[model samples]
Target: MDYVIEAPLVCVCDLDGTLLRSDATLSGFARDGLNRLINAGVHVTVASGRSLQAMRALLNGVELGLPVIGLNGALISELDTGRHLLIRALESTPARAAVAILAAHGASPLITSWDGTQDRVHHVKTMNAASDWWVAEKREYGDPRLRLSEDLEGVAGQEDVVLITGFVPDQAAERLLEQLRAELAGAAIIHAGQHIYCTGWTEFQIQHPQADKGHAVPHLLELTGLRGSTVLACGDHLNDLGMFAAADESIAPANAHASVLAAATATAASNDEDGVIHWLLRRARLIGAS
Candidate 1:
């Protein structure tokens, strides 16, 4: 779709392997392209798996006025206000059940709880070497938010958790993924990145069924009061499929996973070469914003 009419368009972008380079930094090419869109009056924001805190950290230099989607749709936070427009948390009963099942299968989850203003992540202190890698890697960033405990089952007893995520070996991730999907009746079980961020690990995440990127699209649209605007989405993984379903059009980077590539309306350059920038330049022009 050209989206060339005189009306504004809404562009929701995924961060990790879509807008950010492999090293997880937004490139100047994209920054300039986004600025052009802002000047042209398009509504642009990010929909990412990153938490709100992480998104703000990653978007340090960018002056984005629009509210960004975070935690894969678990939140819609406004940077200027330091407030959340939406909060979707998992129910206690099923979430605890999920943890028990995964734990039984030798998976230790990093439980994510949103205490309205911040994310309180709790993980079991006693764990195997595989789970330790994910924990240690985050610690290397000096992110003080993670709260580890030897008594994680007690720490995670509450039901208002936003998400629960974990990492495992590539071989083990497959079996856990299947088990989580079949057993966790009321939740969303997902797998991503066989080797996330260059690390040789596979990731697993669980959330409320309502906490989906596709749902975030409409929530953002409603909150912005930008009804009827064309939805332009871009992503690079299976997790982005929900975002694609909510779009009038979608783009996937050249390096995107095969499933994401198939779902996109078009394919652009790889992330390392400013693929999102290339797509946005065209979008800005089509809407007379260029």
Candidate 2:
């Protein structure tokens, strides 16, 4: 497969169930496809909700020199320099208030902070399969600053917090979001799918006060020194909608969320089918050469 393209084109990909299969591993086909693109000089960057520490492990062997967009755009860091290009922390007042509201609703809120580098997330005792994502990352990154509090009042005041997440049972997630909207009037709330709820501060106050992937994409383009038209973004969740909306062209894995699939310009194979590599090869014209 010789889908090799020239350098300077920017390709931003979402990690977790997008680039990596459900087992949290990248397929050989995806790796080779991405390598072909990089060898041809295209820039590839991972845009993910995972902290830098977790992302580093997943992207460990891949060699693409680009800053990653983490925490759904709350943090952007240069891979080589370790310098953060952007850090959008939710205002403490609103974060704290939002935490209180979730606690009252009996939601298990997790507070996350950037430890100058990488995220330090705190969660309660209950566990689920999705919890594997966080647990494995924590083991790899070392134990996080764990806090098991019923009240989130003090959790929000921590200095330099970037994201706050909570888990709602599949049945109640939607209703919780509606109630949250009414309670946290000015805050950013997003349905991250898989029964996960994300609440944070908005990136901008002037235009749309919502914190979305759309707002994050423009900032990423500027940081990568590419125009939106020159960028190709791939994602699989609703949180990826903004990024898809902002990309010059975008692809969603076949198993992607319905909304995300609808928003993307193209659909690749499922992640298990090595969709990242499949699409890259097709787009770059690297489909079947040595």
> Against the unseen true structure, what C-alpha lDDT does each candidate score?
0.78, 0.68
lDDT tens per residue, model 2, 1-290: 34346555788899876889877788776776677778777888888877776677667668878788877787787765656788778777777766666655566566776555455666667644344345555766565555455445665676556777655555666677777677666665545355322232111111113345566767877776666438888998877887887778889999898988988899988888888667776677765732
TM-score of 1: 0.89
Question: lDDT value for candidate 2?
Answer: 0.68
Name the candidate that leads on TM-score: 1
The alpha-carbon RMSD values of the candidates against the true structure, listed in the order shown, are: 3.4, 5.0
Candidates in order, TM-scores: namely 0.89, 0.83
**Which residues of candidate 2, in runs, are more than 4 Å off?**
1-7, 115-119, 124-137, 140-152, 195-211, 287-290
Can you list the residue pairs that collide in candidate 1?
none
Candidate 2 accuracy as TM-score: 0.83
